[model samples]
Each structure stands twice: as C-alpha cells, then as structure tokens.
Target: HEALADIEDELAGLEAQAMAEQQRMALKQALSELPERTQEIFRLNRIEGMTHAEVARHLEISDSSVQKHLSKALAYV
Candidate 1:
C-alpha cells in the first residue's frame, strides 16, 4: 500500500510538469502568431497576471478594447 501511494504521487507530479510544459508551448506559439499590440496585451493580462483594467490603463485603451484584442488573440492561438 505504501509503494502504491508513492507511485501515485510520482505520477501526479509528472502529469503536472507535462501540463505546465504544454501550456508554455501553447502560449509561446500563440505569441508568435500575434501582432505586436495583441501580443503585448496578452502578455500583460495572461503572462504578467494583470487585470484587464490594468492592461487597458497601461496600453492607453479602454477596457472593452482590451477585451476585444485579447479575444482575437486567443482565437488565433
């Protein structure tokens, strides 16, 4: 029983690492396909973990425009 628990823990860790790598690749591929402004907004909101309002303020756009660009960028990704 102890051995089985240890194996399960190891499998869980491997699965988490694989998922992280896949997400990293996906974001990288997405960024490559995005335009400069779209990439900046996505990086700020998704990678940098900023709020939409914060990204809008920094980029000098409205929050709705931020949302629009993010939506388009995600669709491309």
Candidate 2:
C-alpha cells in the first residue's frame, strides 16, 4: 500500500507538470498574437518579475502606458 501511494503521488506530479507545460505553450501562442511592444512589456512584468512601475522606468515610458499594455496582454491571455 505504501508503494502504491508513492506511485500515485508520482503520477500526480507528472500530470501537474504536463498541465503546466500546456499552459506555457498556450501563453506563448497568445503573446505571439500581441504587438511587439506589448509582448516586451508583458514579458518584463510577468516573466522577469518587474513591477509595472519598474517596467515603465526601464522602458522610459509612463506608468500608465505600462499598465495599459499589461491590461491588454492580460485580456488576450
């Protein structure tokens, strides 16, 4: 029974990993459909762990613009 439980846990972990990969692929496809600037902003904020303000500062754009781009990206994804 202990061994069976261990196998079940391992299978659950594999299923979770597969789901994560599928989500990643879907996100990538959605991002590809967005404009280049929007994609960059989204990546910087979401993937690079930058806040909206930080992304704005780094890109030399207004914070509002960064928020707008993120909103658009979020809507698509």
lDDT of 1 at 1: 100
C-alpha positional error of residue 50 in candidate 2 after TM-score superposition, expressed in Å: 1.5
- Report the C-alpha lDDT of model 1 over 16-58, residue by residue, as the tens digit: 9999999989889878888899999998999899999999999
Error of 1 at 31 (Å): 2.0
Q: In model 1, what is the error at residue 67, expressed in angstroms?
A: 1.7
**CA lDDT of each prediction against the hidden true structure:** 0.93, 0.97
TM-score of each prediction: 0.75, 0.93
Residue runs of model 2 more than 4 Å from their true location after superposition = none
Highest-lDDT candidate: 2
lDDT of 2 by residue, 1-77 (tens): 99999999999999999999999999999999999999999999999999998999999999999999999999999
Please estimate how well model 1 matches the true structure, expressed as its whole-model Cα lDDT. 0.93
Worst 10 residues of 1 by lDDT: 26-35
